[model samples]
Target: MVKWDEDIYNTPAYPVTDAARYLGIPVVTLRSWLKSRPSADNNDQPALEPLIQRPDPNLPQLSFTNLVEAHVLRIIRATHGVKLDKVRKALDYMSQQFDTAHPLVMKRFQTDGVDLFVDQMDRLVNVSRSGQLAMRETLKHLLTRVEWDEEGIATRFFPLIESVPESEKVIFLDPAIRFGKPVIAGTGIPTASIVSLIDAGDEIEDVADEFDCTPAQVRAAIQFEAQNRAA
Candidate 1:
């Protein structure tokens, strides 16, 4: 078991809607991923299992860790067009092999789990060798946005505010800061707060100066909020 800090990241902090907004995933899609439902084609078939377990099964909320898992799932199932069944199988295999419920957020996933996951997908879906390589590379790139602690559990996540380089960490979500809300990377200023200032008719440069952040950072905050709103 990965020993997550119970009071911090593991606590149910975000409601289903909030989590979906932060992850740029559709609310209905996220709900389906969180709550198992009968297949549309056949109610007689077994209900699909949820991809990520909520911190409190009794509540319809997600912990920060769950958000991370959803983020990764978005990249795999949505961006890469990987099938849901294949993803579930790959995650199950990784869970058994790694002895951790949340394998995708673990630090070692970048080093070891990516290849294993890709190989499993290849076997399950018969993806071409080149497709396997592409999947591996894509997964590796996705893992770059997650930052893990000494215990190999994810501590922070850098969400893409725009179509920028992976190495550009302009905005981040840390459980320790702003109740896990996305903030300007190093300044601890909430991106939404920055956008609020703009909405209030404050100049971007003035907001940046007020926050002691660069104009570029203020623009990033606007971009992040715009993306969330558009989603």
Candidate 2:
């Protein structure tokens, strides 16, 4: 079996727009975040480094780490009202302290770094205890999506579909399945395949029956793909 982390880290499979759609962030915003832009202050200073390095050298694709980093950023943005500047500062501090390129996506963040980062973030700015807890809670929820390896590293991420309810995870990104594209749980059928069948005028019920999945799963796939296409 292909190791989960290897399946993710080694493949530049996730296009920026697809990842942005899945992550509920704007494509342009996500692209901007991934770019190393010239500093506004002075030309002499170094270009700003991206939060997560591009997975593919030739193209702008996000690895699982980039996806996870963006997911955490979404949480921070929605939950804490944290500016990108503050989040970047916190990431820089943790990256320095942990000696890791992406601390938020690494296993150590869950084990030890969450509290450390949160405390350090409090020092950087006044965040209430409630706010801190909220952030931690959001991280916990995000962590649930990750399937860890024996070494405690993230191997797979069961990304939640936005159109689906919190109680339901109709699809996920798995390195061992469908070349890591989003698919329904238990079967490696790509969500796009289902969407394609429906777009061809096939009945959702027949597709579900053929795939041995629920109607809800079929609809979820179609909804997710349609949303991404629209975006």
Candidate 3:
């Protein structure tokens, strides 16, 4: 059972359970984590703590934008392909919208993190070819600082656009999600490999039969590959 602050109605309210669901934190564990924070007095010097240490009983009452930001942060910490630039912009945007006590810094990456981010975003979004390359490069310019791990991989940020609703299409422009592989809409199977078998003189019926997919699915793969090549 949980209660929310009605004073912040414009902000969506979540039960402790919903917060746990959206943030992927277990309810009991999240409560314990929140309780572990050092109590902050308004008169204190810094006046605030790092995110993991912030104290707020009604954290579930966050503004809609901040809720998304916090959710995004939690997601990024799990998903490795999201870029810091997008995360920075997203965090700052949410802070402005929700009046967060701490705002994220917009930093650029020194390594291949931005490229990876661009690649991932492009794969999820169906941007036109003329703008695809430019958009990828523009994403890189948005950050001023970045950090990577011992493996040189940028710390992955979460809630991939791929997981979002509109990006569910199986178009040619999206090939980064499944190993530089283009998968069918809503399926993990690759489009290119499927179409390749058909193009190499394999009967559409035979290929479909071998793959355990409908003939319509095989045709879709062929069409998708053809359109992409034409583009």
Candidate 4:
């Protein structure tokens, strides 16, 4: 069974809406992945397996580890056209092998799990040689956004904003600051706070000036909120 941690410091508590924004994934999509909502007509249908087990089975929001799984899955699905069921199977394989509920956050994923994951996907998707290399690199990029303890367990996530790739990020979700809300990398200003000013009809440059951030950052905040809400 997956471990559950309710202590705020030990697990991410980003609401479903905000977690979706930081991950650049739709809220409904994330919800569907985290929990199986049975259709009104299909009581006998087999339950769909979730990709990653959340730290809390009761809460609707995602934890930091859950966000990491979403991040890597997004890249694989988008770039390689892999299906979610296949990804779920690969995760199951890793979980059983690694003896951990959250394999993506562990050091094992980057080492042996990456090859095993790619191999499973290749069987289902027939990824090319270059595609396999790309998959490995994607895994590496996912690792970069996480902060690990000396024991090598992932504890904190510096969420790369949807508008920014991990390689070119200017925003992050630090749990200690602003309650783990997405913010300008060094500044504690919430992206949503800046975006609110723009939504209220303030110009981007003016919002930037008000927040002591660049016009581009204002734009990023605006884009993050816009896309997230739309999801």
Candidate 5:
């Protein structure tokens, strides 16, 4: 059996659709990011390199690291309205300077790399001074959802239960746990399982009792499932 620490996080585990659903982005957007394609106006130019690479070129799957990288990209693109092309240029520069294929997942990115990325973006695009500040703040906020290990690698991802100021870390995805499915933070209980019980007509209090979790946790799981379904 493969040891839990032996490339478990990097193993191709999530389907492209699942990754997009988890990250709350459209499937087409995720596919565009993973597959190289010609520029819209200049089809003659060489295709841009994919932002995240699939473990197998033929398989439409993503590892945990890919999910994290895409999540960061989603935040950068959605929050500040920066185009993927500009984000790609900034990421390419960072990848060369940081000497890592996955620069966004590096813990150093939370500290040292954000400024470099912001400065690079300023040079690559016409972002205002205040917009640069907003970009930094947004990156800082995005980093809060990621938990890093001692080796400075991302270990756990807390997906938003709701896209609101009061969103809590009630649900998380750890590749080492349950094949990277979303689970309640302190328990191994899958959020989908909890939501399933709720869908089967179990009351929130009863489902919490059944799972040995809080009613609030069950509610959060339900809300997460609802959001994913709507997405």
Candidate 6:
């Protein structure tokens, strides 16, 4: 619930590499835009401010507002009902522009890029705001496809971040909890109940489609059961 600042929306207060990570773009792209100069206006407004990095030869002279505005619209559309206030807040933090209303205008937009932007934004905000709506199948698919950096091994995916401990696992199994079987670890819902749905000819996607979990979590329960069976 930490509200961000309105000023400094696109300024390089943080490292460009970090900013690119937040924006889900490559640092090279961001740097390319930064070096470009803005088109001259009839009234002769000064060009966009450049990100003052240790001068690199590869920097292009381009308009910076275009890049910033693209990110703003992309984030706003992705979040759905992203309050003007919130968008403004995010902009202030990212750009470091204190003036809320800048005169810069965007000439064109890339719809495909916007969609890609949304995908990354969802990766960041979906869990915190709309966990229920997030597709479990999608989660399972991602977990299965995730590549571990250390060993280059593709191991089974688990909802470790949201897993219930054994001590609290029983609590999740209580009939009175989470509509009688949520497997909440301390809340309601049995983890096995969700997995059972998967075993009962329902696809993991289908199982999570009706349940309040990702497909990865549904699989976690199955894996947990397999381990118990082996032991």
lDDT of each: 0.86, 0.77, 0.43, 0.73, 0.86, 0.38
lDDT of 2: 0.77
Please state the error at residue 207 of candidate 5 in Å.
0.9
Error at 89, model 4, angstroms:
2.6
Q: Per-residue lDDT of 128-185 in model 5, one digit per residue for the tens?
A: 9999899999898878899888888888898876743434688889988998999998
- TM-scores of all candidate predictions against the true structure: 0.91, 0.87, 0.28, 0.75, 0.92, 0.23
Per-residue CA lDDT of model 6 for 54-123, tens digit only, reads 1233433211223344344433434354433333334333333323233112111122222333344455
Q: Clash number for model 2?
A: 0
Looking at candidate 5, what is the lDDT of residue 98?
Answer: 92
The CA lDDT at 142 in model 4 is: 71
**Model 1: how far residue 219 lies from native, Å:** 0.4
Tell me the alpha-carbon RMSD of every candidate. Answer: 2.5, 2.7, 16.4, 4.6, 2.6, 18.6
Q: In model 3, which regions exceed 4 Å deviation?
A: 1-95, 98-177, 185-187
Model 4 agreement with the true structure over 1-231: per-residue lDDT tens digits: 333344443474868777777777776777777775453347798775567567667776677667767777777776677777677778778788888767777766767778888887788678899989998888776767766665566655665556565576667665567777778866789988997888799998888889898987887777777766776
Model 3 TM-score is 0.28
Error of 5 at 228 (Å): 1.0
**Taking the tens digit of each residue's C-alpha lDDT, what string does model 2 give over 15-93?**
8888888877888778877877676669899987876676665777787767878877777776677876677789999
Q: Looking at model 5, report the run of 10 residues with the lowest lDDT sum.
A: 1-10
Q: Count the backbone clashes (under 3 Å) in each candidate.
A: 0, 0, 9, 0, 0, 31
Candidate 1: pairs in clash: none
Clashing pairs in model 5, backbone N/Cα/C closer than 3 A = none
